[model samples]
Target chain A: MIRAVLALARSDLFRWHRSPALVAATLIPALSMGVMVVALTYAVGRQPVALVIEDHGPVADHIIQIIRESDGFFLVERTREEALADMKAQRVAAVITIPAGFEDRVGSHDAKLDVFINNVDLDFSDDVRRSINEAVVEVDAPSLATLGENDLPPGTVSGIPNPYRIDVAERDLRTPDVSFLAYQMVPVLALLSLTAGALVTALAIAGEREVGALRLVRLSPVPRTAVVAGRLLGGTVASGALLSAVVLAATLTDVLSPPAGRWPLLMLLLLVTAVGSVGLGVLVGLLTRRVTTTAMLGVNVATASFLLGGGFTTIAFLPDFVQGVARAFPTYYAVEGVREVLFYDSMPTLGRNLAALTATAVVSLVVGSVALARVSARPH
Target chain B: MSSWWRAFDGGLRTQLRSFLRTPMTAFLVLILPINLLLLLSLFALTGYNAPTALVMGEDTAAARSYVEALEDTHNSFELRPMDLATAQDQLKRARLVAILEIPPGFEAGVQAGHTVPVNLTLDNVNLDMAEDVRRAVPAAAVIFAARNAFPEVRIEADLRNLLPRDTGYVQYLGVSAVALAACIAGAVLGGTVTAREWELGTARLSQLAPGGAAAVLAGRLAAAAVAGVVASSVTALIVWFGYSVHPVHPLEVGLTLVATVFACTMLGGLVGAGLRRVMPVAPLLIGTLLPFYLDSGALEPQRFDGEWLFALAHLSPTYYSVGVMEHAYHGLVVTPEPRWLLLLALVAIGLASLAALPRVARR
Candidate 1:
């Protein structure tokens, strides 16, 4: 039985090696994920804002300096007319204008700075608002001294040195802040393994069925269970090899870190994920019976799994209902587990995630084997 | 003229009949775009609500008031009251965006006219959301300080939005979603319809039957373009009426949609002719469209991102399509000379289509 399984698995691998298009199809998710990560790095944060400084006062210059020094605003110095035109053209997200005599009115408590924002996306506009507010606070209430000093009348709030001043200090939980690209790349790795395993397995079996080789196999003495196990093993090996190369490349490129001491656990999780994916692929192959249809089904299933499994965005950020829906996909557990082991250095729900993946693998394998046996039993 | 008309009519009818015969064709043509739009919109709607935990170590009147102050500040944080241990666990798992820890003696220090520092422990995995939390915390503090202490300091900073009204992030993304739908529909339908002929060995029959292959190809292209336009329009209407994203110039948006459909269909036809396989069309279209969507000023102005990205955006038709749609829908000229760029794209794609069709028909 072991010999027959090894022979069948070898043949499956040999057939896949002959088809470059099938290999290319399996690599599509990884390629797309790479492009998305690069694009996302450029897409988020530090929006462009045109700065029109009409005031030459010391305080106004200080405000301008503060805005320049801040990390949130990519400042473009422009004249008022130019700034307005740029804002209208959507070339810049917001326009900040420092009015003339803005410094002179500071002691009188009537200083006002105008901000014209293109509020197409409130998320971005809110960033601009916060940056401006920070600038104001820096100028007016430096070190909490000027919070209540300049504006107080002679005796109203007498000797009450800034009745109340709030100081905010933020600490990041992650030791080294994860870039958006790094954060998204972990799930992309899982997606790669899932897609490759499922696609290769489905296409291998479906291609055999399409060419009438499956009928010959049934006519032979090899059991159907051996054929199914062989195909699944072949697919798992191919997917595991491909994913290992991707991880190695990512580590070399500094896109991801090495697994450190968690390599064994990571390998185990990836192995389980690949087995589950191969089982699904075999079932799809048995159902479709055509290479093209099987490939299409594999692509669709992979895409759906990727989207719902937090491949593109964090699942925690999604709506409650969508998060609930995400729990159904095995890819979610694979991604969640991989991310924890790789980045967080601790597996919080390792048991639950492993159980889900193991169940998926067992169920899919059983159902797929039964279906293959039934199909093989028919007289051809 | 009569021969051309007959060939076009026959080809259109044949293409339509062929497409209707396959249920998968209908699903790809009609259902996929709507699904993508709905999914992408759902994604856009999320991630805006930053989950935060408020830990009140000192439960005093001032602490309670400060908590209330954070709550009242716009959709900044979805606050949950939890102990420090639970907050730490949640933060580690990235379940919460941040934890605003109000240390003991916060109220006492504030009431004694001293500076009370609030520690905000953040999970900076998503920098965009982290920036939101970082800025929001200080803004809320300023509001609290202004109301309590600085009564005479009246700094009236007038905020004038360039648009007539504020557009939510999801609404802004809806315009791009329509373009994405058009791109996918045009590519998948046009590619599949053209490629399936060769895959099923029906191209020879078409070649043997009638007038020049160009005319037949034109007819097929017309049918696919129409399907693309109709499917994308359904998505647009959902975004417009269902999502309350009313375009300022509805007629202009209609015109832009037609142009986008034509351009994308022709492009897809070129790819179909080149690949000449049914199975590769979907994956190829998806892979090609994703990068284009990202670099196409869909999220923000592409030029502002960087010079490298701006250079890449010029190569994608979706960029010009998104630019034209943004202008037509929201009156914001996100790209320079968008109408001219779209016209150039349409002409280029039309020429490319004419060149690629003979190759496909001959195959």
Candidate 2:
């Protein structure tokens, strides 16, 4: 049985290799996903702002120094006009204007400040607002400390305490090196499963029809179940090898640094996902008798699934309703399952996803088998 | 009087009928952009508070009071109490786009007449959102602090707010639909109807007819352009009427249709003629072309930032088609308006035809 599956898998893999277009389909998505991850990471990290100081006073200077110390922002002193121009150009992400007399006014209890931002760039504007507000809160920190002893609330800190306690816990399971690789690699899992699921079933059945092979296979005494299983095995092997290569590349390159205990479980998850993908492909092929229609449907579903499943962006940031809408697609599960393996180092949730995927596979296999059986049983 | 005109008319009618038949083509043509416009308008329903963050100095009840105050104050924000790393991750995903970190010595700094260090982590991906969070958070924090500390020094923000009115994902989608129409037309007809003829070796027989190779190629291009224009125009009209999207100009809108058809024809015809087989290569063509469709600002364009992507967008005839459509929707004065956009479109269409001519002529 192992040898048969292996033989089927090897043939399917070779078919992919021989077909230049199929090879391009898989390779382009993998590369595209890698590029997208880098773009997102860089976009997230590079946050710079323009700082406008209306008061060039000693106290305002002290606040500017504190702003410089934060390391969260880059402060460039520019006029209001300069800042607005820069913000419009997207050269400066946001603008912070420290109002005139900002420092002395804080002691007088009438401190007022104004900040300007180009609302077109929503993310950076939000960040600048937060940073500048914190700076204001910090400026008022000194004056508020000097009031009467009773003026302070119980928990309000008037001064430093005894021993400062610091506890650090790393919630991200993947290491930085693997984190980057995991970032690049995770997108492929979705690309592979959807492509594999749709392709295997469609091509296997369609190619047989084209070559007059399905007609002959139906004439044989071998149960239609055997033929369907054989094709499923072939698809599983192809998808498995492709997925395993991605895992091996990520692992070797330090992109997938799974905890030692989780290795067995991760492998199981990969195998199950591949099986489910193949079942989906077979079902698509069986339903769409025409080769062209099957192939088109396969590409459409694969591409659309990747975009809508939150594989490219975080699900949380998307509108509240879109997230729920995203879950209805299987691509979401593939991504969520893989993300769990990489981020949490746990597999039971992945196991549940695998179970769900397996159920989907079983149903697809049964439906595909019935459909193919009927088509084969026909006179033509 | 001319055979070319007859071929063109024949090509247009056959193409239009075939286009109207497919549910996929018709749906994408008529519904996708309109649906997107409706989706974008949903953003006008404001008062949905983005989840916010507050870093606590003492990690005690007072900190809870501070966070609860923020929550109760506005319908626009929900405060999340978190540590530095969690806050950082939230900001990274634009989840908690703003984070208020109360330093270890925050309360102590307040008491000693020292600078109390409070850090606000801002997600700068959306610059506007970052700025709003920056201003609103500090103002809220200072107001609370004023009631506690120096009650005399009332801190108020005279905000110079110049925020862009919220535009919908649908507007963006409306921009993308123009590009999608070209791709769908290319996918449905390009190189296929004609390439299918060539694959079946009917090209030789057609070449032997009275008008010959030029006439056949003209007919094929006419068919493709008609399909491309109708699909794109239908989508555009739906966007205009259904969503009230205003184009940069009526001429630019017409130009968008022309440019997309030319692009679809050149790319699809070139691929169709170049590949020898009909069935296998068709899937390959669709797969390879599929990315260009999605990537070409059809769904979203600004997310990618390589020089290659920029250069590709500039070079794409579809990009100009989409750009013209965008200018129309946004009503941007394209310098001298229609003249410059038309000149560029003509030059692009001319170049596209020239590139394909050599390849088709050899066949």
Candidate 3:
């Protein structure tokens, strides 16, 4: 059975050499997502803001220095006229202004900064709000903002704490903060694997079915189950080859850094995801039996499942019922499973997701084979 | 002239009837685009607020006020009261974004003159999320100090929004997805209809017709554009009723959606004629949509990303679509060009692509 499956798989894999468009079709979505990820890095970080410092006092200078030192805001000096014009034109996200206080207001401890922000959306607005709030707090409590940073500023003593009544200290669960782009890259890979594996396998099978080749396979000496198994293996290997390039590029460029010795586990999770996806392809291909329909449906199903399984956001962030629904799909497991191997050290949570993924692969292959056997023994 | 009109009318009617008769084209144009919007909007609905745990170690006036402050930053976190252990466990398993602890001495220290730290144990898996959490804590602190009249907290913010109100992320994305719908409709319907001639060997017939391929191409594009309009309207309605994203400028929204769809259909026609295959067009269009939307002003003004990326953004029809949609939906101008100019540009793009289709069709 294994040998038969291998032969079937090998034939399917080698057939791509005659048809390069098939390979290109499989990689398009994944490559486009890579481009989107690059675009997201621009969207989420370092927004451009114009700073108009009306007050030339020492405190204003200090705050200006803090704003410059702070993360996430792309600050530039702009005149009042230019800043307002830029804000009206949507050239900058926000305009920060310091009133001409003459440093006397600080003695009363009631200084205020006037900021004009273009509140387009919560994602952009919230970043500005949080950042402004952070900048304000750092004036009174710099230590709180610098939770991990050991560098001492010119004015403040290293050991000395601020005299504020309230302070906020945020401790990360993991060291070395992972980039949002990198974290999102995990689910996108799952999306790619699912899309590529399923789309390729389904298209191949459906193409064959169009010419009545699938029913012909049933007349072969090999067990029908082996043929389905071979399809699954072939799809996984083909997509695995393409996704492997992404994984390799990401690793080489330091776009993704999994935990030490976790590369094998990560690859295993990807293979499992592809297998499950390919299995699903077999089912879709068998059911549809049309190349175009399979291709269209494959893209839609993969996208929907990818989003439900937390492509852009955390599954925890999803509603209770939606989260429950997400858990039922292999994509949910694929994402969480990959994150387990990538982010966490212990990974006690990996077992359930792994089991679910493996079950998906097995069930799809079995169902596909059964359907293949049920088809009439005929030739085109 | 009359013959051209006849051929154009005939081409339009035939393709329009195909959408009704053919399952694949209907699925490609109407069902697929709507499904895309629904899935994305649904994801947006549940995915905004991070699920967090609020562990009140000492539930005093200060702690309770702190909770209120945390809650006031409405868009950031959805805090639920729980024990530290449960929160930690959930955080470890990726169920919670963070655990906010008012560690035993919080209220007392806050009531007193000494500084009291509110510990936020965060799952910093995604740095953007971690930044939001980190920033929210300080945001809450600003509220905390102001409410308590903490003297040492000197500087404060007097924020003035340039826009009247901030549009929610879901609404923004939903509106953007309307343009995405147009893009899909254009590519799939436009391409498939144009490519159908070649695939079914009718390109020869169109070539032999009195009006030549131009009239046939226009007829096909117009039919697809109407289908594209139908697809985007359904999406816009979904965005309206489903997500409460009411278009501020109804006339402009309608105009933009129609024009953008028309442009996209022409582009799709170009792609279809260029590829000359029905099989690859749908997947290619669907696959490329994400990057187009991402680089376009769908998330924000593409120019905000950077100059280089902004330059790339103009390459996408969705960028112009975004400018028009952002204005019509949210009442914000993302592009320097006038909306009328942008709309004209979109129409020009469609015409250019339509003109280019015949050249590809000859092959």
Candidate 4:
């Protein structure tokens, strides 16, 4: 049985090596998401705005500095006419102007900073709205805090009153901020494992059925268990190889700096995930024998797995029902497991993830082999 | 000309009938993108409200009022009332994005006519969510000041919006998803039929027919675009009725989709001709859709995404597709380029891809 399984696995790997198109089909989705992280990195937290300084006074300069310091807005130096042109052309998200006589209005307490925003959609406008609200109030924030904090001092310093005075004093709980792109890349990598494992196995099995090779295997002395075991072996190895390459690339480029000594754990978790997914793939292959159907459904199944497995966010944080659904899928454990290995050395759920994935693999292999035997026993 | 028409008619009729019978094709063209739309819309339904914890150390009127102001913030934070210890613990564990601590001021400072500071402890795990918290706090503070009706010097924003009203996030993404539907339909509908022809040796059959392979390819390409239109219409209706995003210029919206679908199907057909296999073509196009969606500014205009990313946006046809689609659906000109020019670019993409594929199959 061992010899038969090894031979079958070797043959499948050889065929996959020869069929570049089949392999390409499997890797595409995860690769595309890898490309997507770069774009997503830029899409969030940096919106370009044209800051037109109509007043070159010190106060106006102060406002400019505030806008410049804002994390959300990317300010470019442009003249008023230039800014207007950019705004009219939709070249910038918004045009914030420190209008002429702005300091005079501030002195008289009748100032309203002008903001002409291209509030195209709530997603874009909300960022600008919140930032602008913060920027405008920031001018009075320091004075208010200083005057209010002084005990029995003069009524005002730099002449800002303390009536109804309230300000925000921020205390960050974490030292270094994680880039959204890097955090999201973790999910993307798990998705790659899920896609490659299921897709590659499904296509290989589909190919075998399409060309009548499965009938030959059934006629031979090889046990059904050997054949299914072979399929899982080939699929897990392929997926593991892809996962290794991606992790290597990411680490080499300094994109992913997982803590030292975590690579082996990461490798183990992802490979086990691939094993479980490939078992499902074997069943998928048996169900859809045609290459066309198998290819389409393989992508679909993997996608469904990725989505149900806590896509782009934490499963524990999701609504209870959604989390319940996520727990039913193995990829969920894989995603959570990978995050643990990468971010924290001591993962509380590491044992649970390993147990769940191992059980899934065992169940899938048994079911897949039984299904294969049933199908082979049927009339041609 | 009559033979050409006959061949074209045959190819069109064949694909349409074939597509209706093919459940797999239907699943890819219509069901997949629709499922994505539904799943994604569910996420957006949270209205981008990030979860944060509020720890009220003081039970005074000032603290309560400040909490009220935080609630009034523009869908920025979903405030969860928690004790300071619990909030700090969640923040450390990365479960909560931030914790707003209303320290034990007791409103005494407010009664003394002094400014009191509310501390905000942020996890800052991901700067994207953290910054939203960072900005929302001060914005909330400003509101806190305004509600007090303070007689002190206060500056407000005199805002001028380009649009008459703010377009909702779902409304925008749902509309752009129609263009996405077009892409899926084009690749699956058009690409598959073309690849299936070669996979089943129908390429030779077309080669032997009247007007040669080119006429059949053209017919199939046209039929694919037409199929894409029908498939995407279902998506559009769902976006309209399901998501309630009625088009501002209904006729123009239809035309924009037609143009986008037409272009996409042709490109898909081009890829099909080159790859010549149904297995690789569908997954390839579907797989790449994510990057294409992001690059094309499906969620927001690319200019705001930064210079390098914006420059890369020009490489995707989706950039042009969403540009015209947004204008047609919401009357919002999202692109700096002329709308007509953008539409023209989509058409050119279709024509150019069609031109590149071997229409005649000379070999």
Candidate 5:
């Protein structure tokens, strides 16, 4: 049985090597995802934003000086027309225009300040708006007591003086920034492992039917269970190895933390997932009975799994019902397990997630095996 | 001309029947778009809840006074008597945008009429919410004082900046319909029918027919093109009837639909014939569709900035589809310029390549 499994796994690897199209199909998503992770991380980490000032007056200069004094913003432009053009082109994030006599009006306390920002950016637009508000917050307010003190005498302040002031307080309860790559890796690796497992199984089963090798396998002295088990074992090894390589590469590159404390348990959980996925592939292959259909079904399954697992967006933002539907999907557990290892830096929750993943894998494998056995037993 | 008409009719009938035959395929074609629209509608509904604010305080009367004042206002606040650790956790969960803290003044500043410093701690990561909180706090502070002063001093300033600007519902729905165009075209043009013919060794059947393979391929192309148009239009009408959003210009809509059908039909033919399998075709289609949907300016494009990202988005047929659809929904004139012509040319090239696939056939 071991020899049979080894032979099947070797043959599958050889097929993967020879088929450029299959290799390309599998690698395309991985490459794109890698690129996106890098691009977004870079964008978030260091965004170059210029504040273009249109006013040439001292007030404008003071405002620009204030902005320059602040840490996040860069005063990159001067002149309103140039700023507006740059803003439309997205070269500059915000433009602050101080209308003429702005300081004079503020001195008299009669004029209001107006600010404009291109709302295309939810992040940067809000940043500029806040900076402006903070500037206003820092400005000293002229009270009636101060006015009275200036108008009458310093000791002449009388009547029930206002005895109230607002006290603002804030608290932040947040997890540290988890690497977007690590966050994304959970779903990516799960999808990759499941897809590879399902594809290899489907291809092996469908290829036998297409090339008339199934009859040969059936006629051999080998028991049907041995043949099925060997094929599933081969698929399980291939998928488990594929995911292991990705996790290892990520660890070496510092994209993922090395598995710790319970590496063997993680491996066992991954193997279970692989076996279940193989069974699923075999069931789909048997039902479809066509290589093309098997491939299409495989792609559909992979894409739907990724979407349902909340790969591209946070699950918290999705509707409550969608979140419920997502929890029922197998990829959800796989993703959770991966995230536990990569982000939370914990082993216990990893065990729980892996246990759930193993349960799902076992259930799928049983249903798949039964379906495949029934289909194969039917007389041609 | 005669062959083209025959091709169109046969293609329409064959495509429709094929779509109806496979319920999953039909679901892929019809339901995915509706599902996305429904999802967007769901976002439009529950998304209107007032923005969330975070209020923090120590166990003091000043803290009590601040919380009461905030609660008296119209905004929603997640009030918590927390230490620094819990405050940090609340920020990560995004349950609180800004934290308001009152120091141990013991009511002395109010009695002395001194300007008391009220410190506001905000998650600088979310700049918008910080801005909103900054604006609301001062106003709420003023209003709270006014409630004790003359009741007539309760002049609420209509804060327009606190809310997002209106980018009409029709414009939003238009983007989804255009995105669905790519997926629908992919299913109709690239899926089982073309792949099955290739796999069954029956592509040779068409290749050996009259006018050689090109004529048969042209017929399929013509059919696929017509099928793409009808499918896109039906989905467009759903947006119109279900959402009561009309295209800005009927002519622009017609031209845009025609261009999109051509582009998708050609993409389907080329990808289907080149891959010669439904599985590869589906992934390729989905892989291409994903990024296009994300960057279509439907929700947020300003989040990420890269010339290459924008360049890739420019190549997507959905981008042009969205542009023309937006223009149509706004009652603007849709002109078929050089860019449109170029897209049409690409579609033609795709059809020719698919027609020539017999030469590229493996074994």
Candidate 6:
């Protein structure tokens, strides 16, 4: 039985080595994930803005200076007409216009700043609006007072009094801050593992069936269980190796931390995820029995898992209904488990995650084993 | 000329029949676009809701007023009144996004015109959500201060939106989704169909035909372009009816999709002729689609991202398609010269088609 399993595993390995397209398909998602992480870092924060200062007064200059100092705005000075044109072309997110007014308006404390924003994306537009509000606060900071400074005369002090202060003392409960790229890369790594294991197994099985090789195996005296076990073992090893390489690269590149004492937990989670994906892939192959259909199914399943299982976006950000659906996918547990170990330095939900993954792996393997046995028992 | 026309018609019919026979082709060309639209729309509808806990240490009027102020603001946080211990527990469990605590003597300090600090504990596990909380807290404080200050001094900042209306993230993505549908149908489905002939050893049939390979290839290209248009149109209709994004100029939307389909179809034909295999076509097209989708002002204007990405956007058909679609849907002029861009895209399509015709005609 062991010899039969080893022979089957070696054949599958040789097949994988010959099929460059299949190998490339398995690795494409991981490559794309890397690019996504880099792109996302560049995409967030620090939007471009056009500054059209119609007023040459000190107050206008001060506001412009404040806008420049804020990290949120990357300012480009333009004339009013030019700013309008640039905004129409989407070269800038918004146009900050200082209306024609003398510095005398500041003495009256009724100075107003006009802002024209292209509110296409609420998130980025909100950032622009918030920055503008902060600038307003800074401009008006001189007239404000601290908690107990109201009794002092306003003009007696050289500086401004900040009367109402709302201090935000942030206490983050997690470990050191994870970069956006690192945070998003965690799920991408898991997604790569899932896709590679499932698709490779499914394609290998379906391709064998298509080429009449599985029928030849069935006619032989080898036990059907050995063949199935060998296939699963081969897939798990291949996918596990790929996933480990990805994790190693991420850690070496400083995209993720290799938490000491947690490598065992991480490896266990990865192994279970691979086994579960391979089992699921064998089931898909048994059902489809065609390479093209199985490949399409694999792609669709991988995409659904990636999108709905918190691969690109956080599960907490999803709606309640979607979150419920996400919980049903094994990728969700794997992602959450990996993130908890790598980022938070704690294994709070390891038991639950492990139980879910193990349940998935056992159920899929049982069903797949039975189905493959039945198919092998059929007359060719 | 008559014989060539007859051959083209025959080839078109044959291509359509073959496409209908293949279940995968039908699914990719027809069903995938609708599925993507619905999924992307669902993603758009799932707005960000921050889970927050309000820890009131002192039941003072100012503290009560502050809590009320937070509740009244048009914020994304789902604030609930909880004790400190419960808040801490929830935060540790990742159930809560942030906790806002009003300490004791908060009302006295504020009533005496003192800068009383509001303790805000944030789970910065997700920095995007944390940033939202940071921005919202200060805005809420300003609102509370404005309401309670003795001398009412308000800053009058006149804000004007340049766009006709606010476009939601989903709505923006929906427009891009239409373009994306066009690309997938034209490239993946069309490329697969065209390449399958070579893979299945049927290219000789076209090479031996009376009308030559150009006529047969034209028919296939036409069928693929039509399928691309139909798929993209269905996606547009879904976006219109389902997402409430009505295009101001429906004709422009149609024209943009048709042009995109033609351009992408030719590009796919080039790929099909070059690769001569169906298995690699899907992955290649889909893999390339993502970077194009991301860089082509799908999420936001490409130019605003940075100069490099903005320059890179010019190389993708999606960028021009998105430009025209944005103009049609939201009346936003995202590109400086959209017509020129479209013309350039058409020129590229013509060049690619010319380049691919010889390859498809080869024995």
User: DockQ for all models, in order?
Assistant: 0.46, 0.21, 0.58, 0.55, 0.20, 0.42
Per-residue lDDT tens digits of candidate 3, residues B14-75?
98887787676476557777777766776566434668899989878888888888887737
- Write one digit per residue (lDDT tens) for candidate 6, span B23-78: 66466457666766655555455333467998888997788878776765434467
Predicted candidate 3 versus true structure: per-residue lDDT over A298-374, tens digit per residue: 76777777777777767767667877888888998888889888887568679988899999978876776676556
Cα shift from native, residue A34, model 4 (Å)? 1.3
Off by over 4 Å in 4: A137-164, A167-173, A259-265, A307-310, A313-328, A344-356, A376-379, B42-47, B58-60, B83-95, B104-106, B151-156, B306-308, B359-363
lDDT of model 6 at position B361: 44
CAPRI tier of model 3: medium
**Error of model 2, residue B100, in angstroms:** 10
Residue A297 displacement in candidate 3 (angstroms): 0.9
Clashes of each: 0, 41, 0, 0, 24, 12
Q: Pick the candidate with the highest DockQ.
A: 3
Candidate 1, residues A1-380: lDDT per residue as tens digits?
99998988888778777766676777875687678877777676677889889887677788788778767788899999999887776678888888887878866777888889877666677667766665666664443322211344311222333323566554565655666777778778778888788888877777778778777776778878887778778888888888889888877888777456887888888889988888888888887876556655665666667777776567887778888988988888988887777667556887888899999999998898788777767655
Please report how far candidate 3 places residue A375 from its true position, in Å.
Answer: 3.7
**How do these models rank on lDDT, best leading?**
3, 4, 1, 6, 2, 5
Instruction: Pick out the ten consecutive residues of candidate 5 chain B with the lowest summed lDDT.
Output: B151-160
List lDDT for all candidates, in order. Answer: 0.74, 0.55, 0.78, 0.75, 0.54, 0.73
TM-score of candidate 2 restricted to chain B? Answer: 0.59
Q: Which pairs clash in the backbone of model 4?
A: none
**DockQ-best of 2 and 6:** 6
Model number with the top lDDT: 3
**Looking at model 4 chain A, which ten-residue stretch has the lowest summed lDDT?**
A147-156
* TM-score of candidate 5 to 2 decimals: 0.73
lDDT digits (tens) for residues A1-74 of candidate 4: 99888887788788888887887897887777667667667677667899877776666677778788876788
Off by over 4 Å in 2: A1-11, A29-34, A45-116, A121-187, A207-213, A216-223, A313-327, A345-351, B9-205, B229-258, B275-313, B317-322, B331-354, B357-363
Indicate the docking level reached by candidate 1: acceptable
lDDT of 1 by residue, B1-363 (tens): 587778888888887786677556465466666766766665566546678988988899888878876775545788889999999898887688888888899878877767676667777767667766766665566667665654444343556777687667787788888888888878777777677667676666766645766677678888888888888999889988988888988987888788878878888887777777666676778777877787887877677676678878877778888888887788766676657766578657757776766765564
Q: Write the per-residue lDDT of candidate 5 for residues A28-71, one digit (tens) a residue.
A: 55454455445444443222345544344554465556556543
